[model samples]
Target: MGRWGPDARGRLEAAALELYTERGYEQTTVAEIAGRAGLTERTFFRHFADKREVLFGGSTRLQDLVVGAVERAPDTPAPLEAVVRGLEEAGAFFQQNVGRLRRRQAVIDANAELQARELSKFAALASALRGALLRRGVADPAAGLTAEAGIVVFKTAFERWLGETGQRDWSSLLRESLDDLKAVVAGDEAQADPP
Candidate 1:
């Protein structure tokens, strides 16, 4: 993140997403992406293995960042709070990079293959998040439920972030989505309870 290179990984990621949207993911080659970004193809390959990788480029690193956040959070944090805290930690990666993400999301929303890959990546992140929670000694059902809930918050926050034309914060939106999720859960529970 800190000055990876003259044509660092982030620039490549941005260039690839823009090209993927304009040219279509299937048609955009690594060479073309690198060239568009004024970088060598080797630089592109170094950052991303293939075109699809560009769409999901930050996921692995984001997963790690979120896990680190989980580990760093207060020991007695609630399950939902823990999830939001983890997401907040990871949100830094997207704070100034929403444009690239919106482009990638646009491409993914339009392409079934990309959408499927996005689904798979999300599942993988959920699994990783669940593991992180358990590693911190978070109990069963709560850990699994919180992980899924965290994913919902991330998707919702991301979409809300995309809705805006002007710059805004990701963490605030992320937190609000989780809060809304809690409200929904509370309402559902109330409906289920007898009068």
Candidate 2:
């Protein structure tokens, strides 16, 4: 590849993930990742601040997607429903990139720092969602609660989706997780099954 190659960022991410999987995250260096991608360390830095950013570079985009979905949703739905609508949009995004997400999750699962960063990303997403809710005229505690609950639904569904070997999709898992949350909230004993 040329020095100023197209898709340098993508090539760097794929190379980083491959190296992280083979040599472990801490063991992989930015130089090695760039070399694997046939690019320079400067090129990697231009695309990402550090090696960790390879796994996290899409966070801002994801937050925008979820928040934008909530902002664009019709105002008629309840706060939680509006949040779910946002999550559904995110689900579509994840569904289209399930393979990369699964690989990313595996990398995160293997490292403490990456796990903390993952949690931090979720917190940011919740905060953004809360802001979106507030802008929609939802009250303080309700907005906060709905945003947190939406994150829980998303996390649970995503974990299940990652663990599954079947053909189930992200949106279906999100809906199932949301239903389970509702059942537990309503104290519907028969409806809430143990997972």
Per-model TM values vs. the true structure? 0.83, 0.92
TM-score quality measure for candidate 1: 0.83
Q: What Cα-based lDDT does every candidate model obtain?
A: 0.81, 0.89
Clashes of each: 0, 0
Per-residue lDDT tens digits for candidate 2, residues 6-121, read 88888998899889888899999999999999999999999998998899977888889889999999999999989888888776667777788888888899999999999999
Clashing pairs in 2: none
Clashes of 2: 0
Task: Please give the distance, in angstroms, between residue 87's alpha carbon in candidate 2 and its true position after superposition.
Answer: 1.3
Sequence-dependent TM-score of model 2: 0.92
Task: Give per-residue CA lDDT, model 1, range 1-195, as digits (tens).
Answer: 323566477688878878887878878888888887778887677777777887786788888888788877888988778878888886667766767777777888988998899889889989988988898898889889889988999889878888976566777888778878878978853456566
Scored by lDDT, the top model is 2
lDDT of 1: 0.81
Error of 2 at 116 (Å): 0.6
